[model samples]
Target: MTEADFAFLREYLRKRSGLSLGPEKRYLVESRLTPICRRFGIATLADLVGTLRLSREGPLERAVVEAMTTNETFFFRDRVPFDLFREVLLPKAIAARAPQRRLRIWSAAASTGQEPYSLAMMIHEAGAQLAGWQVEIVGTDLSTEVLEKARLGLYSHFEVQRGLPVQLLVKYFTQIGEQWRLNPAITGMVSFKPLNLLQPFEHLGQFDIVYCRNVLIYFDAPTKTDVLDRIAKVLTPDGAVLLGAAETVIGLTDSLVPDPQHRGLYRQTAVGRPAMTHRLAAGF
Candidate 1:
């Protein structure tokens, strides 16, 4: 692809999806979009860009954005985030919502349902302690394709093998031949939606915990700040937001501040509530 075509794609993705593609990432663009060109019978990336320019908001445009957005995720992909949820965030949310007995968690970058499903599994493991509480998990992504896969709650053997404990796998999943499907009880606990973090999301309602892991790294500094600030508006007064292992709120926005006790967990300072004093809970 010529520099002009590449620049067009970079700006297009950044505007629509908040992705910042530098000049060095030309290969990434070419490799990921080449298949789309073939599928559409377009000759090259430049032709693809020309078509995209002519047909904004068409199925091809949507497919291009989805293909470029990284959706790499697995069950409990990183141990620490889930541990933070079970040990610190969950107990904190449980205590905070005891009066209303309703708790909501948002997997903001819920790629294919693993994170939310894992949380539902943990809540199920809570058993008696959470018996009477009303808990909900909503998983949202920019890609409708992945969201559909998530709705099905189906996983290949390789998918189940990644960071998923065998015990929980056996207990929560049924083998469908060589693949595993999450049980209805766990699958039904969560709802999926199509969301663009670059857009308004307050309509989704306030959440006690928002897991925005590994999603913001693709954005530029300004986009990161804007997304985090908007996220603050949808957080419950004492709600927590979790970032990816490599992501942080420091120097990004003042709306959120890091939890003193955890690495990736953050709470909204925009609400004027005092920082939560976290107590580590039992193992999951």
Candidate 2:
């Protein structure tokens, strides 16, 4: 691709998906888009760019965005976040919503459903503690393709092997041919939808916890700040937002404050501030 074509792609991706690409990512763009070009039966990247320039919105535009957006994730990825969810975040949510007897969790940028499914598994294990609660896990991503797979609740051997404990695997999954199919008991806990974080999320309603892990690393500072601030709006006060281990709120936005004990956990600022005593005591 020439400079003009590459420039168009970079801007197109950034505007549609909030993906920030520097000049160095030219090769990465080429590698990912080449397959897109082939799939569409287009001859070259320039032709693909030409096709996009003419019809800016349609299946083609979505295909490009989904292709470029990274979907790398696994069950209980990084371990510690799930640990915090079980020992800390979930407990706080349970406590805060005790009067309502309802709980909602959002896995923003939830690639292939592992993160949300992991949460569901833990909730299931809680058994009596969560028995009467109306728990809902919403998993959203920019890619419908991945969302479809997540809806199916099926995993390849390699995928299941990544960060999944064998006991939970046996208890919650049934071997289907060579792949593992997650039981609907856990699968039913989550609902998947295609969402662009740049767009408003008020329609998703308030949540007890929001997991936007490993996602902001793709955007520039301005976009990252915008996304974080918007996230603050959808959270219930005292609601927590969990970012990727490498991502943080410092220098980006003041909508959230980091947890001293957890690497990726942050509480909503101002009214969303953590009620330390109330939060720690609600582990039931």
Candidate 3:
């Protein structure tokens, strides 16, 4: 790809998906878009760039964005986040909203449904604790393709093997041929939607817990700050936001502060912060 081709794609991706691609990622872009070019019958990267430039709202534009957005995820990824959820966040949220008997969770950038499904399983395991409560888990991603897969709640054997324990798999999944299908009871507990982090999210409503993990690293500093600001608007004042283990709010935004005891957990920084009476912050 020429300098101009790279420049156009970089700016286009940044504007469309808040992705900050540097010059070193030229090879990565080439590899990802080459298949897209062939699919569109375009002969070259420059030609694909021209086609995209002409029709910003075309199907090709969506294809390009989806191709570039990483959708890597699996059941109970990294372990600690889900551990913290079951042992800490869920209980606090339950008590915090006991009067309303409602619980809301947003799995921002949730890819292929594993993250939200894992949460659903945890809620199912809790059983009576959430018996009469109104629970909602909204899993949103920029890629419509992955959202469709998530809606189906089907995974290959390989997918199930990644971080999903054998006992839980046996308890929640039914074998279909060589694949595993999650029970509708669990899949019904979550809803999937198409969302762009660069856009407004007020329509999604406030949530007691928001998991915007591993998605912010793609954006530049300003975009990261802007996205965090929008997230703060839809998060309950005392709610928690769990970022990726490598991500943090320390130098990013003032609207949230890290939970001292939990590595990837954060709480809203507004006044009237909830007291840490329970040892919820002790492990994970």
Off by over 4 Å in 1: 271-284
TM-scores, all candidates, are: 0.94, 0.93, 0.94
* C-alpha positional error of residue 237 in candidate 2 after TM-score superposition, expressed in Å: 0.6
Clashing pairs in 3: none
Query: CA lDDT, every prediction?
Result: 0.88, 0.89, 0.89
Q: Whole-model lDDT, candidate 1?
A: 0.88
Each candidate's root-mean-square deviation in Å?
A: 5.3, 4.5, 5.5
User: Ten-residue segment with the worst summed lDDT in candidate 3?
Assistant: 275-284
| Residue-by-residue lDDT tens digits, candidate 1, 69-165 | 9989998878898898889888877787788888989999998989999999999999887878989899999999999999999999999999899
For candidate 3, write residues 1-284 as lDDT tens digits.
Answer: 89998999999999999999999999999999999999988899988988887855978899999999999999999999999999999998888888989888999999999999999999999999888999999999999999999999999999999999899899999999999999999999999999999988877877789999999999999999888877876777778899998898878788788899998998887522332211124310
Alpha-carbon error at 280 in model 3, in Å? 26
Per-residue lDDT for 54 in model 1? Answer: 81
Ranked by lDDT, the better of candidates 1 and 2 is 2
- TM-score for model 2? 0.93
Instruction: Give the distance in Å from residue 253's predicted Cα in candidate 3 to where it truly belongs.
Output: 0.9
